[model samples]
Target: MKFLHIADLHIGKRVNEFNMIEDQKYILEQLISVIESEKPKGIIIAGDVYDKSQPSGEAVELFDDFLTKLVSLAEFVFIISGNHDSPERLSFGSRILKKSGLYIAGVFDGKMNKITLKDEYGPLHVYLLPFVKPAVVRAYYDEEIESYNDAVNVIISNEKISMDERNILVAHQFVTSGGVSPERSDSENISLGGLDNVDASLFRNFDYVALGHIHRPQKIGRDEIRYAGSPLKYSFSEARHHKSVTVLEIKEKGNVKIDLIPLLPLRDLREIKGPINELIKIGKEDYKGSTDYIHATITDEDEIYDALGKLRQVYPNIMILDFDNKRSRSNISFEELSSEKIESKSPLDLFEEFYEAQNNKKLSEEEIKIIERLLEKAGGIEI
Candidate 1:
C-alpha cells in the first residue's frame, strides 16, 4: 500500500508579521495535485494541524475544504493533533467523520487508535498516537512515567502489537537516537534542557514510524523512522531546508520504500548581506526574486540615511534590516569610566569620546559644530 506522510501543517501561521494564508493555500493546492498524480491509498497527517490552539475562522474553513478534497482523492485519511492544537476542538465530529474514511485521533483515551487496512500483502495496522506528555500518560496508567521516554515506552508496551504483521505508527514528539537531537527551527516551541525527548529505540516493533514536531525532515535511528517536516519554511534558520512530502510504499513486513517529493513555496525566504547601495543595485539588475521575503545585513562603515526606506524601494517584502558595521561588532565597555576621570574631563570632551565609541567613528565637523552650539546655549561651555 502506498501512502503520503505529511506533518506540521501549521495552518494560519504568520512569519515576521506577514500573514501566510495565501502561501499556505497555494501550497495545499500543489499537494493536492501530487496526490492526484500518485493516487496513494491513504494520507497520514502526523500532527500540528494548526499553528495555535484557537485558530481563526478562515483557517478552520480552509482546513475543512482541504480535508474534503483529500478524502475524495484517497481511500483513507488519518489526522492527529500536535502540541499546538486543542484536542477537543480538532476531534469535534470525529466519530461522524470516521464513517466517511476520515479518521482523526486528537485526544488520547488511554488506548491507541488502530486502523486495519487490507492490501495484496494481507492486513496492515496503522496506529495513531497523538502528542502526549508525561502527566497525561501518568494519569491513565499506573506506570512510573517520569519523562517523555518513559511515557512513550509505557504506552507502546501496553498496545498488543504484533511484529509479524506490517505495522506503522504515527506520532508527534521529539525522538532522539544515542542522545542526538533532531534538527530544530526557531518556529518550534521546544522544551528547555531536552526534557521532552523520546528515545527512538522504543519504536522497534513498528515497520514504519511517521513523526512530527520537528521542522526539518530527517530520520532518527533508521530509514523507516522519520519526520515528514513542515511543508513550508517557518523561520530564517530553516531558509536552506528543502521542504518535501514523504511518500512510503509498504509491502510485506520489513519491506518499505521511502521517497521524498519536493514542495515549492509561493515566496522563498532568503538572507543577503552587502552595502545598501550595492544591495539595491543588485535587486534591480540580477536579483530575479525581489518579492521574496528577505533578511538584509548592511555592512557599510559609515551610517547611511534612510537605509530601510532605500531598500524597501527595491525589496518591498524585506522582513529584517540589520547593520554589521564596526559599531555593531564593537565590544567597548563603559564600565571602565571612573568617577575621578569623569569629573576631570570636560562635558564636550566626554560627549565626543562617547559618540566615537558608540558609532566607531569621530563626529563630523558639522555635527561637532551643532553640538557646540547646543552646549553654548545651555551655558555648559563657552565656544
Candidate 2:
C-alpha cells in the first residue's frame, strides 16, 4: 500500500500581512502533479487544514478545489481536525464524503475511526485519531485523564486492534521521544508545560504512524513514526527547513519504505542583516529578481532619515524592519526588573512607572484623572 502523507496546510494563513492563498494554491497544484506521477492508492492529511477555526470564503474554495482534484486521483483521502480546526465545521458533510473514499475524523466521539483497505498482502486497517485534550476524553471515559499521554493510552486501550494484520495510525499530536521535544517554529502555538506531549512509545505497535502538529519534518523515535511538517515555511524561524511531503510504501506487517518529495514555494522566507546602505545595494542588485519575504536588521549606529522608505525603494517585499544599534541592544532583561518592588507601590505609582517607561515622561494630572475614571469604571479603583 502506497500513500502520500501531508499535513498542516494552514490554507488561510497570512505571513507578515501578506495573504498566502495564491501561494497555497500553487503548492497544492504542485502536489497534485506529484500525485498524478506517483499514482498513490491514498493520501493522508493528519491535521490543521486551515489557519483558523473560522476560515475565509477564499480558503474554503481553495481547499474545495484541492479536495476535488485529490478525490479524482486517489482511492482514499484521510483527514482529521487539529487544535486549530472547528470539529463541527470540518465534519459538516463528512458522512456523505466518506462514501466517495474521502474519510474525515473531526470529533473524537470516544472511539478511533478505523477503515480497512485491501492490498496484495492482506487488509490494512488505518486508524484516524484526531487531536485530543484531557477535557474531551474525560467527558466520555470513566478513566483518569490528567494528561495527553493518559488520554491517548486510554483511547488505544479501548480500541482493541488485532496485531496480526498490518495497521497504520494517523494522529495529530505533540508527540515526544523520551524527554526530547520536536523542532518548533515561532508560527506554531505550543502550549505550556508537558501536559500536551504524548510519548512515541505508545504507538510502537503500529506498522506506520503518520503524525502532524509539529511544523518541522522529523522522526519521533523510529523510521515508521514521523511528522510530515508544514508544506510551506510559515515564519522566518523556519527559513532553514526544506519543506516536503512524506511518501510511504508499506508492503506487509514489517516492511515499509519512506521518501520525502521536496516542495518549492512561490516566495521563500528569509532574513537579511547589514548596514542600511549596504542592504540597499544588495536589495537593488535586481529590482525584479529579489522578491523574497525579508526581515532585515539595520546595523547603522547613526539614525538614518526615512529608513523604511529608503529600504522600500530597493526591496519592495521587506516584511520586518529593526535596528541592531546600541539602543535596541541596551534593553534591560526581565529578570533584572522584579515584582518584589511592585508590592509596595500604589496603583498611581505603578501607572506612572509604566507611563515613564513608554513615553519617557510622568503622567500629567489630567491624564491621571482620565486613568482614574477608567479604573473606576472597571471596578479596579474608586475615584
Candidate 3:
C-alpha cells in the first residue's frame, strides 16, 4: 500500500506579522494536485494541524475544505494533534468523521489508536500516538515516567504490538539519536538543554515512524524513522530548506520504500544583506523574486532616511529590517564589564547604563521619570 506522509500544516500562521493564508491556500492546492497524480491509498498527517491552540475561523474553514477533498482522493486519511493544537478541539466530531474513512487521533486516551488496513501481503497496523508529555502519560500509568523518553517507552511497551505484522507509528516529539539532535529551525519550540528529547532507539520495532514538531525534513537514527517537515518556510532561519512531502510504499512486513516529492510555495521566504541603496538597486534591476518574503539586513554605517519605505518600493513583501553597522555591533556586553563596577552603581544608574548599552543611546529625562515612578511604586532602592 502506498501512502503520503505529511505533518505540521500550521494552518493560519503568520510569519513576522505577515499573514500566510494565501500562501497556505496555494500550497494546499499544489498538494492536492500531487495527491491526484500519486493516487496513494492512505494519507498520514502526523501532527500540528494548526499553528495555535485556538485557530481563526478562516483556518478552520480552510482545513475543513482540505479534509473534505482528501477523503475523496484517498481510501484512508489519518490525523493526529501536536503540542500546539488543542486536543479537545481537534477531536471534535472525530467519531463521526471516522465513518467516512477519516481517523483523527487527537486526544491521548490512555491507549494508542490503531487502525488496521488490508493489502496484498497482510494486515498493516497504523498506530497514531498524539503528542504526549511526561505528566500526561504519568496520569494513566503507574510506571515511573520522569522524562519524555520514559513516557514514550512506557506507552509503547504497554501496547500489545505484534511484531509479525507490518506496523507503522505516527508521533510528534523532539527525537534524538545517540545524544545528537536533528537539524532544527527557529520556528520550532524545543525545550532548553534537550529536556524534551525522546531517543529514537525506542522505535526500533516499527516498520516506519513518521514524526513531526521539528520543521526540518530529516531521518532520525534510521531510514525508516523520518520527520516530514512543514510544507512552507515559517522563518528566515528556514530559508534554505527544500520543503517536500514524503511518499512511502509498504510492500510487506519489514519492506518499505520512501520518496520525497518537493512542494513549491506561493512566495518563498528569503534573506538579503547589503546597503539599502544596493539592495533596492538590485531589486529594481535584476532581482526576479521581488515579491518574495525577505529579511533585509542593512549594512550602511550612516542611517538611511525612510529605509523601509525605499525598500518596499522595490521588494514590496520585505518582512524584517535589520542593521549590521558599527552602531549595532558596538553595543556593550555586560558580561565583559567588571562586577564591582556594576555593584557600585545605583539601581537607576544601572538601568540607564543597561538601556544605553542595548539601544546605543541614553534614555531621555521623561523615560527616566517613568522608571523612577515605577521604582517608587515597587518601593525599590532610592533614586
Model 3 CA deviation exceeding 4 Å by range = 286-288, 331-336, 339-383
TM-score each candidate. Answer: 0.91, 0.86, 0.88
Residue pairs clashing in model 2 are none
TM-score of the candidate numbered 2?
Answer: 0.86
Error of 1 at 275 (Å): 1.4
Q: For each candidate, what is the lDDT? A: 0.92, 0.89, 0.93
**lDDT winner, 1 or 2:** 1
Model 2 / residue 106 / CA error / Å: 0.6
lDDT score for residue 162 of model 2: 83
**Steric collisions counted per model:** 0, 0, 0
RMSD to true structure for each model, in Å: 3.2, 6.5, 5.3
Candidate 2 has an lDDT of 0.89
- Candidate 1, residue 306: the lDDT equals 92
Tens-place lDDT digits, model 1, residues 1-383 = 99999999999999999898898999999999999999999999999999999999989989999999999999999999999999999999999999999999999998789999999999999999999999999999987989999999999999999888999999999999989889899999899988799999999999999999999999998999999999998899998999999999999878899999999998889898998888998889855577888999999999889999999889988999999988877765456788888778777778888887788889999998899889988976754
Q: How much does candidate 1 score in TM-score?
A: 0.91
- Weakest lDDT window of 10 consecutive positions for candidate 3: 326-335
